[model samples]
Target chain A: MNKYILSKKLYRNELATFYSFLIGFLIALAVGSLILFIQEKNPFDVFSLMLKLSIGSVNSLSNSLNKAIPLILAGLGISIINSVKLWNIGAEGQIFMGAIALNFVYINTSINNSQIYILLLLVSGFLGGAFCIFFPAITKVLFGVNEIITTLLTNYIVFGLTIYLINGAWKDPASLNFPAAAYVSESVYLPTVLGKLSSGFLICILFTLIAYYIKDKSVFGYEMRIAGGSELTAIYAGISAKQKAFFAMLIGGGFAGLAGAIELLSQTHRVSTGISQGFGYTAIIVAAITGMRPIGIFLVGCLFGALTIGGSVIQTIGVSSYIAEIIQATTLFGALVAQFFFSYEILKKDEND
Target chain B: MIDVQLMGLLNATLQAATLLFIAALGELITEKSGILNLGVEGMISVGAVSGFITAINTESLFLAVIVGVLSASAFSSIHAFVTVVLKQDQTVSGLILTILGLSLSSLIGKPYVGKKLEVKLESLIDIAEPSNIFQVLLSQNLIFYIAILLMIFTAYILKKTMFGRRIEAIGEDLKSADSMGLKIAKTQFIATCVGGAFAGLSGVYLTLSYVPYWTDGMTSGRGWIALALVIFGGWKPYRTAFGALLFGFLEALGPRLQTYGFEMSPYIVKITPYIITILVLVFLTIIKNGNTGAPKNIGIPFFRENR
Candidate 1:
């Protein structure tokens, strides 16, 4: 006859999050190494090669940064919604919708000034993502529907829609049978600031600063925090919990959309089926591992960006690029475990003695 | 000719429904026990690849099914340990499990891409030439019959058994269930594992009977649809089965409609399941006023001391 009690610690150990992330990251590396070993590859050589190719030189680093741009934006988007305790797991679809919208503008408009063209495309892109989530957000607010399923379902719908567009209306004639839209005008390409580093990197950092200000310092964020913590408390404090949630979802969608537009302008130069490459989904991991901190998302985004680039680079060596995804997922699991220990502890107790 | 075409459509519908029903039923059990494992997609992928690999290696459909189910169960245990043992956020943990499952399967299944399974599950009814609709329906693989039996068994268990009551009790109110000498963590963990097993079984069906081959990302988003079916069915076994059949009908309608001279695009047909899920969710929410038969304690990690 015995009883054990699980108790929450009175004071939060802030350091635990950092330590858990470190340990979790290391665990993911170990798992990745084991997988490589199982495939008869030298784990040490593979690891070192990945590191060298991803971050060894300026050009390689710039490539990683280019890859990180969309992740940073999408991660920031997910982080914003996560702060309000909402799951916007449809970021992948949102990214697609954003690209679709940007392409729509490109096809319809005949503007000569690239700056105005880019600005308009960005707006359309943001609107597209927002439009995709609008139904789910509204339904959640009005009918109390679970946004997670609704949002996730929308991803499939958008995916189908994207395929439809690329295969039909947007299919480029000069593409020689490829199912993709025509490239934007040459002037519309985003200017590179460094060795192949698009200005999108600076844009993402700017977004990070703004998101940090809004999430941590603004009155709106404080109210959102209150709403997320307890609706009743928010109501007592005269905050409209529904409004906070609705707007937060829209902003999250907008961020994802902006990411898609930036990717199109700065990198892809055209809307294709392969535009996103799971950036939105990976961004969720980035957001979680960073504890939804904007700056942390930026840093982790770069790391993942490098991992993704390195993953492709190692394909020449006969390794599966999915190793990056596996490591990322394992790291998230580690963080989850770390989060558990950070807040609670188990104690043994004697009963009826 | 019309009769044959109708029967063909019916057969396809049944096959697709079988896939969704098994997975959704597993999810229903897990949700009923207060765990929402969103990693069903990953589990299905793992199951399909693992089962395909096993079948290719051992050339035994039975052993492939067992390995598939066992591997998925073991894969899902990671979610159980994190959410049940460590008390982490179920949604986040489940999502992570999904990411892990998907990538791990793709990585492991890399070399096996384009490989075909020589072993096949034969139809239970050995009518060399079927003369009637009933005979045609009866000529499905053994797994099809097993799925029907499972549906009935699940309905009965949830309606009439104490074990089912324990699951519902834990889901509805974990604190009360815990206080009443119920084994909270054990029930949830087992339910989640059982759910994973069902997903694995579904995967086995895909590789062994449905397609008879392995491909990367083959499961696609069927796992997500299964999750939606659980909601659309309002957490009841029979209703969930009905929802699965409805989805199956949509999936079957696509290729059939094209054959029947309908001018619908395949992409439009592909999206019907997802679109219907959202509409049904909305419709259910409106009618039920957001009180759909979801477990009250679902997705919330339970800790006795928190009370």
Candidate 2:
């Protein structure tokens, strides 16, 4: 009897995610094929081509890993915040600031310790992101302003301010008309580990695992989850919402900031105006779709990583990668629709039970 | 000394004020009816691009404006359907619409970049070049007049009309509205569509009448400014106009201050709108931060469960 129950529980767990993911994948395939049909392109050919580009070759896997780097970090950032029930929408700004700070260091300081260099970038990123969250959280707590608007608008500030800096003071000497700062020294840049994969992907893995451990095994995680699950209960238990919100935003900003710094140091090795490109915003989707699970985020990040690689190949093949965007938008719509079904059942009523 | 520059400033201020004023007024109507539309920015961008495109294609400015309004209304209708019918979370769904609209506009409107149009010039005022008096008082576009009339009408309707009273009731408590036999969906949908249409027209004004050009991100945070102005106005129509005017003056002040050759850093002046927003939000919250000012059901999405 116990074996039967255990087997059933295992079956249910496997079946739940299996069905949900199957539904998600089928919807994506159907939509993708529909678009291809309208364009008179063969769906099977495109699908095969996308698959080959994403994983059929060594270079494609490397491309996907590199693309997955920021996404993994972003996934972790979203996972961290959602644990505390705080939506950190300003990850983009934090990431932008990280890139800016890293550029400042890259242009100004000359460093030779390549191993320790990674630590410097990570710390700088964390601090920069925390700074962005400081004023916004203060305003939300003290003045009753919504952080959603304040955090979102901060993106504009980061953009305009960075552009102003690059245009006026930090313009690369060789970039001519375009406003980009100087690239980092080779010593400061992360070394490529395996087949075009930057060491940044390893950093993402380390951070994500650390984040998972902290969330699942730490007391801070418990306190935060308790606070998030029941604010009233937390208050009754003497936890302050103000403090929780502040701490949550701080941690959230720090992770995002670290992601940003690493992105600059490892990938571009320079700061530019287009540093963010909605990584922070997309992190929210990643977090939501992963159900805020650190492990689930790991898998989802890789899937998106593959999609992005596939998209690049499509772009090279002379098609706009807006097909990818349409897929993302539809997936978002589908996920939200699916949320209603996760814990609910619809059945026809009958006299016989 | 103040009068000479002041008159020119005032004229510019009035013109700038009219565009956002109409938007804030319309937003006020919906918010007062208890629906906060975060899709305002997207709707505005669509309106501006659509209006600009239609004007350029047709060469008839009036038809362009109509197209702009209708285009926004059509998009806004989706917002109404999603929130009212589907019962999805308003905040997230609205933001998604924004992201989608931004991408779509960029994708679709890529064809119009760098193209110029013969903008039908509306006389701001038939001001003579030599006379400073004419420059200050006589020069103004017809849209400015329409915006002022809109503010007056919005204020009057919110207080006087039976429909306005129904909106107030619905906003206060949708259950009460339903108990009184009010058509909940119809009222909310109409209010939302009207609000969206106004937001659209406001965008159209930005592109066609004020600046006759189509550039990506031309709205440039103006839609959000209109949202803040709604709060700054205490959700009242006339006050909303005043807030819009105040913001307009602040916006124009950045350039004038630059022209005056003061040794101020451009960054400080450039962030004038944000600084103004912060100050206005602080002031409003301090005075009426309590439940006294904001509409009771402003952010809460109504569910048709009880009634």
Say which candidate scores most in lDDT: 1
Of the candidates shown, which would achieve the greatest DockQ relative to the real structure? Answer: 1
Instruction: Give a tens-digit lDDT track for model 1, residues A73-157.
Output: 9899888887779988889999989999999888888788888887888889888888889999999888998888888888889
- Give the clashing residue pairs of candidate 2, or none: B124-B139, B124-B140, B124-B141, B125-B139, B125-B140
TM-score of 2: 0.87
Q: In angstroms, give how far residue B127 of model 1 lies from its true place.
A: 5.3
Lowest lDDT sum, 10 consecutive residues, model 2 chain A, at: A1-10
* Candidate 2 Cα errors over 4 Å, as ranges: A1-56, A82-86, A105-111, A213-217, A229-231, A289-293, A296-298, A305-318, A321-323, A338-353, B1-8, B128-138, B265-268, B286-292, B304-307
Q: Name the regions of candidate 1 deviating beyond 4 angstroms.
A: A2-4, A348-353, B126-132
The Cα local distance difference test for each model comes to 0.88, 0.72
What are the per-model DockQ values? 0.77, 0.18
What DockQ would candidate 1 receive versus the native complex? 0.77
